[model samples]
Target: MQENLPRKAACIGGGVIGAGWVARLLLAGVDVSVFDPAPDAERVVREVLANAEHATARLISAPLPPQGTLSFASSIEAAVEGADFIQESVPERLDLKRRILGAIDAAAPADALIGSSTSGLLPTDLQAEMSHPGRLFVAHPFNPVYLLPLVELVAGGRTAPESMERAVALYGAIGMKPVVIRREIEAFVGDRLLEALWREALWLVNDDVATTEEIDDIIRYSFGLRWAQMGLFETYRIAGGEPGMRHFLAQFGPALKWPWTKLMDVPDLDDAFIEKIASQSDEQAQGRGVRTLERIRDDNLVGIIRALAAEQGGKGWGAGALLREHEARLRAAAEPAPAGEPLRLMEGEVDAAWIDYNGHMTESRYLQVFGETTDALLARIGAGADYVAGGRSFYTVETHIRHLSETKQGEAFHTTTQILGTDAKRIRVMHRFHGGDGTLRATAEQMLLHVDMGAGRASRATPEVLEAIAAIAGPQRALPIPPEAGRGISDLR
Candidate 1:
């Protein structure tokens, strides 16, 4: 785990948001002690954690550290005793929240940081009754906190600047994007925008302009996609038609005063209105329970994030860029190779997208996985991104793959590489693909040629690279050659 990660953390509530906080912390390999008075608090947290693990297994391709331990404390004091980080997610009532924060402040270590998961409450008020108010701030996350990367960090009047800095690093290390609010204000940024939209949505439903499902369809099928990728200002900048933001504002500025939306009007949330909204939402859900709906939402969100991650030739955009950075850290933190075995270079599960019509792992993904293994080997031997940028890299010239067994979606897999032979400009290698249970699933034998990208011709590897390669190849020479190596189409036939 990285140094930015907390040694021990505590969650003071186990409702939806609190459980989500616990899930995110535990999955990032931070031990968590949770305190919530509800009899079902442990069960709720465990269930949410399970969902988080499932979604994360599909989303993060890099190897994760072993999961951290989780404990349920009998009281807030017990939970926060030695915790370095504490997050509170009790109910929305300001009085109740203040009392809880006060308790947490007194019970937690003097140096421990406390964060309140208050979506719209002012952090200044929440920290008012606290003894060490400097360490308190708001860390507002969206529903399913484990998946959503955006967390708004708002400092109160007394919040220490250093605490804010430390909070940024701590949350960022666990795969979150923590944006500091410029000033303390109710609702912060995201919720302010959402509140305006929600108000309009209510008016639409109240006046029977659109049903709940219809409103949802309008958003998800249109600007929601735009917001997912380019966001508001940038998307409208494109709508500006090359003149940029000024042109956009000039074009749409007049529309803002057109009395088109009842955004400022409040809808009566009387029982009748509540029933109307709930019934419409139920119809939209089609009888799915909350747990089922949560899974569905998580799966959809994963798909959206994954698609964004694949954009821009894989450099990623928006949240995808953040996901890529975290994955890079995970790769850097991967465990070192064992002393006497083939280099265990790559590991991943068969993604749902990798399944074929016959419900087995598709043929092309096998080649892709083997290709990634070869990339890992190159990265290990001093021929990584920087080396390629300097105009030299190894390109595979030939490959032979023999599929030995079946693989299904979500089945865990890994590849081990054995150096067959190596010289100045060429190397031959064998890659064995194995299932999670250690069954041999496939093997690929490949021949690669070192090339100068600028000259587009075979070239000797730099001495440093060759030395690293020799260090790996020399010890492995004592190992016997794999029987599957050097086989051809004729042999297979």
Candidate 2:
């Protein structure tokens, strides 16, 4: 994780999953170039990227790394020309996969690891037409790739052991848990479990035993809650009390003989059945739409990942080493504004909901804007989880804000922060908000106290941190407080 790896990668296919791979890779600070025959791929990628930013900012406890630049290419060869790794996210058809893999193999470097985002397609089948089959493997990721962390890494019969190891290392570097499938299997791992659950759900719905929403409730409220912290076997073991796994299995084994699952049978995807499922699914989704659902899913994922990481030691310190590396990149990208820069500009656009009744920006949204900027600055100064874990943090003690002008909807703004002054225990900062047109919108001044997180009290800044701040603070001095900010104060005495 300490080593800096190549930050550029290419994604072949700009379909739903391919776009997701692009979003995740870009968020992880890897420059991603996408190739797809679809029209308006660039616009599609931008919209996805924008949505990804909002989801990530809300879901992640730590700051996100600066997103990598996204470029679009007309062909597969152009995209993988200089990429360190290649993610093939094309159609599920075996012929399409083989054709794309062959093209990628011909284009990419001999040593570069190529991953397929196929659900259950065997890597051997996909790589049959590849010139260097050893470099290709299945790297199946769950849907909504930006949020989910699990990646099933399967090596085909032609996939060399060294290629599998290299793929693991590369995926690990980007912060994903790459589980190596001992042998290539259909549906990999997660999908197999999901498909099993889907079958029972479909049977229930088809037989009129339950509605789609009701089935969702059953999983989300019952088994899903238990599955979050402790997985199935462990949870079942606990359910057995002190009896252990053997007893638990023996008790449940009898039920296995019953017709509880359709594991061996496949569902008919005939038109009527498809329509019934789709209509019911649409009803269950309630027209909130894909973007809305994706946001909710990503937020839930963030909460789950954070909870798991916290429980397993901050940042899941060991379970997934690659995730830690990704977290580190995020922390670096979200670093706060340096002191004395009158304005600390952040690079994110306003979401639609932030607009007010007048179609102008809301005051509260302004505060959120400033707050996020401040958080980014603090992260920059190393006042984050890792710093807090090491027992040091900065706490805001006071703030004064003055609104000057109106900001309309969809307008981009920047917050500039200045380091006022610092003493042994306290530091002062001033912030100003400016619209993209360079109009001043508001200003804020604040005081922060350094604290020993373990002791819960004020503390002196560490020399290393102080030096970093000093470097960013530069030589500009804080300006005098304006009269508007002092109006309601009792300090007149």
User: Best-fitting candidate, measured by lDDT?
Assistant: 1
What is the TM-score of each predicted model, taking all chains together?
0.93, 0.74
Instruction: Report the alpha-carbon TM-score of model 2 versus the true structure.
Output: 0.74
What digit string (tens of lDDT, one per residue) describes model 2 on residues 116-203? Answer: 9999999888888988998889999977777666799998988889888887777665667779988778888888888888888888
Runs with alpha carbons beyond 4 Å of true place in candidate 1: 378-393, 424-427, 460-475, 491-493
Q: Rate the local accuracy (lDDT) of all candidates.
A: 0.90, 0.74
Worst 10 residues of 1 by lDDT: 332-341
For all the candidates, what are their Cα RMSDs to the real structure?
Answer: 2.3, 5.3
Question: What overall lDDT, based on C-alpha atoms, would model 2 receive against the true structure?
Answer: 0.74
* TM-score quality measure for candidate 1: 0.93
